[model samples]
Target: MRVVIALGGNALLRRGQLMSYENQLANIRTACDRLAPVAAEHELVIGHGNGPQVGLLALEGAAYTDVPAYPLDVLDAETQGMIGYLIELELGNRMPFDRPLATLLTMIEVDPRDPAFENPTKPIGPVYSQEDADQLAAEKNWVFKADGDQQRRVVPSPKPIQVFQLRQIRWLLEQGSIVICAGGGGIPTYYDEDHKLCGVEAVIDKDLASGLLAKEIGADLYVMATDADAAFVGWGTPEQKAIARAHPDTLMEQHRDEFAAGSMLPKVEAACQFARATGRRAGIGSLDGITDLVSGTGGTLISTEFDGVEYRD
Candidate 1:
C-alpha cells in the first residue's frame, strides 16, 4: 500500500517544550519507532510540520546583526534538511540495514498573486500569552492569532499549486526507499515576473500540501496525525465527543463551527478534500493510533460514504 503521513508539529517539538536538540531527538526517535512497522510493510512518503523548528530558527536569526534574517523559503529549506536528517537517521536505526532512505528537499510552487501574501493567517513559532503575543506583534509588526488560550505569530499560508521533483519521489519509492519530503509544506516558492523561480516569504499549510502530494503520488491512504486523539466538538466541555467516522460533507455540515481555524480546521478540511477528490479514506487521529488510522478506525475517518468498507490485506 502507498500511504502519505503528515506529522503534526508535536511530532517534532511538543507545545511549550524547550527546542533543544535533545528534546527534538527524543521526539523524532519515538516517531520513527511508530513509523518503522509501517515503513517495513508499505511504500511510505512522510511530510512533517516544522512550525516550531522554523520559528525557533527565526528567533535565533534575530539575535544576529551580521545579515538579514533568512527568508521564510530559505528557513523552510534549512528545516527540511534538519528535520529530514533526523527522521532518516532515526528511522534507519530501526529498520533493515540496507533499506533505502532518502530525504528530498521538496519545493512547491505557489501563485504569486495568492491572497495569503496580503493577509498572513498560518500560525508558526511557539505559543505565547495574549500579552506577549501582542507585545511581539507590536514590536515586530507581525500578525498574531489566538491559539486556544495562547497566541502565535501568523504568516501567509498559501495553498500548494505544484510539487516539484514528484517524479524523483516516485522513483525513490519504486526503489524501495523510505522518502521524507515536503517538510514545512515543501519550501514555498514561486515564479517571479522574470519567469525565474524564486522563494517567497510565506508558509504553506502542511496538511493541505500533504494531501496534494498524496493525490499527486496516487496514494491509497492519507493520514494526518495530531496531538489530539480525534476532532472533537465542544472540546474541553462536558459535551466534548469524538466523531468516529463521517463523510466529508457530513463533517462540514455538522462540525465546521467547532474546529479551530488555525489548528484542527485545516486538517479536517484537508482530509475531506483528499477523500472527496480521490474517493479514498483519510483519517485524523493521535499518532499512537497509526495502524488503526490506516485501517479506518481510531479516529475521525473521512470517505465517500459513512458506511464505506475499507479494503486491506
Candidate 2:
C-alpha cells in the first residue's frame, strides 16, 4: 500500500534536549530503523517538521550584526534539505544497498488572503521565560505567545491550497524509490500582488500538508508519527485513557479537548481529513510503534466507518 508518513519535529529533536547535530542524527537513525522495514515492503513517502531547527537558525542569524536574518521561507527550505539528507542517509544505511532514496524540494501554494496571516498562531523557535520573551519581542519586533508556562515565537501558518510537482513524487514512488519531500510544509509559497509566485514569511502545518499530499497522491493509508504513543482523551489527568482505534467522527465529537493546539491537534485533524477524504484509515502514534501501527496492532487508527474504540484494559 502507498503510505505517507509525517514525522513530527519532536521526533528528531526531543523537547528539552540539547539541539546538537549529533543528537538529531541519532534520533533520525532511530526513526529510520523503525521505517526501514516498511520501506522495504511498501511505497513510502516521508514528510517532516523543522520548528526547532528553523528557530535555532533564526536565533543564530539574529546574533550576527552584518547581514539581516533570513526569512522563514529560506529557513524552511534549509531545514527540508537538512532533515531530508539525514533521513535518506540513515534510512538507506538500514535498508538494502539497492533501495534508492530521493528528497524533493517541494513547493505548496497557499491563498494570500488566508486569515492565519492576520493572526500568527504557529509556534516556532525555542522556549523563553516571560521576561526574556518580552525583551526579544521589544528588540526584534517579533510576536510571542504563551506556550504552557513559557513563551515562544508564533508565526502565521496559512493553509496549504495546492502541491506542486506531485506528479514527480508519484513517478518516483512508481520507480520503487522512497521519497522524502514537503519538509517544513513545502516552502510556504503563494502568488504575490504582481501575479508572480513567491515565498511568504509564514510557516505551513506539516501534518496538514502531509494529509493533503496523501489525498492528492491517492495514498491507501496516512500515518502521522509524533512523539506521543497514541491519541488519548483526558490526556494528562486521572481519567486519561488511550484510544486504540475509532471512527474519526466519533473522536472529533467526543474527544475534542484531547487534541492540544501545538502538539496532537494537527495530527488528529490531518488524520481525520485523510480518513474522510478517501474513506481510508489514518494512524497517529509514536514513531517507535510505526510497524505495529501499520499492521493495526498499535496506534490510534482514525477511520470513516463508525466503530467503538479498541481500548486497553
Candidate 3:
C-alpha cells in the first residue's frame, strides 16, 4: 500500500513543552518507533509540521541579524531540511528493512492572488506570556494574538494549489524509497512575470498539502497523525463522542456547526477532500494508534462511498 502520513507539530513537541533539540528528537524517535512497522509493510511518504520550529528560527534571526529575517516561506524550507534530517536519521537507523530514505526540498504552488496573503491567521513559533508577547509585538512590529492565556506569533498560511515535486515523489515511491517531503505545506512559491519560481511570505497547512500530494500520487491511504487519539463529535461538550468513520458528505454534515476553524476543522476537511478526490480511504488518529488505525479499529476513517462509511454506534 502507498500511504502518505502527515505528522502534526504537537506530535513532535508536546503542548507546554520547551522546544529543545534533544526533546524534539526524543519525541520523533517515539513516533518513528510507531511508524517503522508501517514503513516495513508499505511504501511511505512522510510530511511533518514545522510551525514552532520555523517561528523560533525567525525570532532568532531577528535577534542576531542586522537585516530583516528571511520570509516565512524560506523559513519553511529550512525547517523541512532541519526536521527532515532528524526523522531521516532515526527512521533509517530503526527500519528493519534496508530501504532508501530521502527528503525532498519540496515547493508547493500557491495562487499569487491568494487572499490569505492579506490576512495572516496561522500561528507559529514559541508561545509567550502576554507581557513578553506584547513587548515583542512592539519591537518586531508583528501581529500578535492571544491563544488561551498565552500569546503566539501568527503568519499567513495560504492554501496549497499544487505540488511542484509530485513527479519526483512518484518516481521515488516507484523506486521503493521512503520519501520525506512537503514539510510545512512546502515552501510556498509562485511564478513571477518572467515565469521564474519565487518564494513568498506565507506558510501552507501541512495537512492540506499532504492531501494534495496524496491525490496527486494516487495514494491508497492518507494517515494524519495528531495528538488526539480520535476525532470527536460535539468536541469538548458533555455529549462528545469519538467518530470511527463517516463518509465525506456525512462528516461534512455532522461537523458543519461543530468543527472549530484553524484546529481539527482543516484536518477533517483535508481527509474528506482526499477521500472524495481519490475514491480511497483517509484516516485521522493518534501517532500511537497507527497499527489499530490501519486495521480499522482506531481513528476516524472516511470512505469513498457514503454508505460504506462507519460511524460510532
| Residue 154 displacement in candidate 3 (angstroms) | 0.9
lDDT of 3 by residue, 1-313 (tens): 8899999997688887899998899999999999899898989999999988998889888988678788888789889999999999999998756689989999999988989878888989888999999899899888777777889888888899989998899999888899999998899999999999999988899999999999999898999999888888778888888888888887787575677677788899999999899889899999999878877788888886656445565
C-alpha lDDT score of every prediction, in listed order: 0.89, 0.90, 0.88
Residue 208, candidate 3: Cα error in Å is 0.1
Please tell me which predicted candidate would have the highest lDDT against the true structure: 2
For model 3, state the Cα shift of residue 272 in Å: 0.9
How much does candidate 3 score in TM-score? 0.96
RMSD of each: 2.8, 1.3, 1.4
Ranking by TM-score: 2, 3, 1
When summed lDDT is taken over every stretch of 10 residues in candidate 3, the lowest stretch is 304-313
- For 1-313, candidate 1 gives per-residue lDDT tens digits of 9999999999998878988999999999999988888888899999999898888888788668698788889889999999999999999999999998999999999997998888889888888988888888787787888787888888899999999989999999999999999998989988888999999998899999999999999999999998988778778897778878778887788789989888899999999999999998888898888887877758778888665322221
Pairs that clash in candidate 2: none
Off by over 4 Å in 3: 308-310
Per-candidate TM-score against the hidden true structure: 0.94, 0.97, 0.96
Write down the RMSD of candidate 3 (Cα, Å).
1.4
Work out candidate 1's RMSD over C-alphas: 2.8
Model 3 clash pairs are 245-310
